[model samples]
Target: MAKQSIAEIRKKEILSTFYEVAKVEGLENTSFAKIAQKLEIQPSLIVHYFKNRDELILALIQYNLDQYKQIFSIAHADDLSHQEHLNKVLDKLFSLDWNELYDDGVYYSCYTLIFRHPEIKGKFKDLHLELRSGLKTILEQCTKAGFLAIEDPATVAHQVYNLLDGTYYFVSMLDVKADQEKYLQQSKTLAKKLIGLH
Candidate 1:
């Protein structure tokens, strides 16, 4: 595999640090100096790459969205059966750690911040719908293969996405007994019931 250039590596490091910091300190408190401190470098290094916090965050959003696409592609580009495919999708949807397909902290933070930033909202909306459409495609394929019972893949796709989002955002905070496997099983059971799977 071709190695990433020095510039590319630095950019990744900076973005990772930004996510870690924002996830901990709230995106409101994330600053170039804080990122620099986290990386043990001068703030100028970050400023040299990004003129301001908005620039850095915009770049991070772009970087993260691309990573999201890669994850989605890998998960769907497999030969899993209908049951196995639903499991794979939900495992990713609910932030399961075994596969580690998505970064929940960064993903949630971007979603939370979008409320105040319309431009970011637009970008994230596109990414969100793209993933939902991917799920719709999976459901349609699974149904064609006689693995599912959903007649309205479009509505089911949105509903499943909402379930995943709500469970992660709210249930994760309110439910003390939560674990990845439990959520995985719950998701499986729910999908099965939704589509009348035996």
Candidate 2:
């Protein structure tokens, strides 16, 4: 059990190193040797946990999804209404200051790799679907409480997701010195309006 625990810890350490290096150097630049160097271990150490580069990439994808799941955990599922739950998710996504270690740019990078690279498409697809369903659940809850129109909550959730994705893309690329708080406020306003929250 001790050996297994150590292995698990090493795996997590390797993943962390991969995330930091990938964020700075991009996914294409992430190599086993680079991660090994960062962790001060043999490249084969990574191979021991991840069979290949593709496997490592898949693990990173899972890590990204886990981060979002954690965000949802803090969200108020029992808020006064479905709209309130939707509001909490949006606030967590845009307003809450996430750590630089796992900032919006990190998510953008992971998402970009998932879409642009076909090698790991199959692995990422299920995770993406799960994320969509999670978002839709929040919307459905809002509709149940009359906070949103009784139209298709899943479709509306997808639209809200697109808005969040677009904002993250803009934040990742643009060098504008505008306040994130203000931008987040505008995002909430638009989200409410789109959901017909009034």
What are the RMSDs of all candidates, in order? 3.4, 3.3
Can you write out model 1's per-residue Cα lDDT over 131-177, one digit (the tens) per residue?
A: 78888888898889888878899888888777766656654454345
lDDT of 1 at 82: 71
CA lDDT, every model vs. true structure? 0.73, 0.72
Segments in model 2 whose C-alpha atoms lie over 4 Å from true places: 1-4, 75-83, 96-119, 177-180
Give the distance in Å from residue 37's predicted Cα in candidate 1 to where it truly belongs: 1.8
lDDT tens readout by residue for model 2, 1-198:
345688888888999899889878887787999999989899987899999977787788788778766657753465445556666667776653532326565555556665767866765677667777887887777677666665887787777768776665556554554655566668768877777776
- True-vs-predicted CA distance for residue 156, candidate 1, Å: 1.3
Q: TM-score for model 1?
A: 0.76
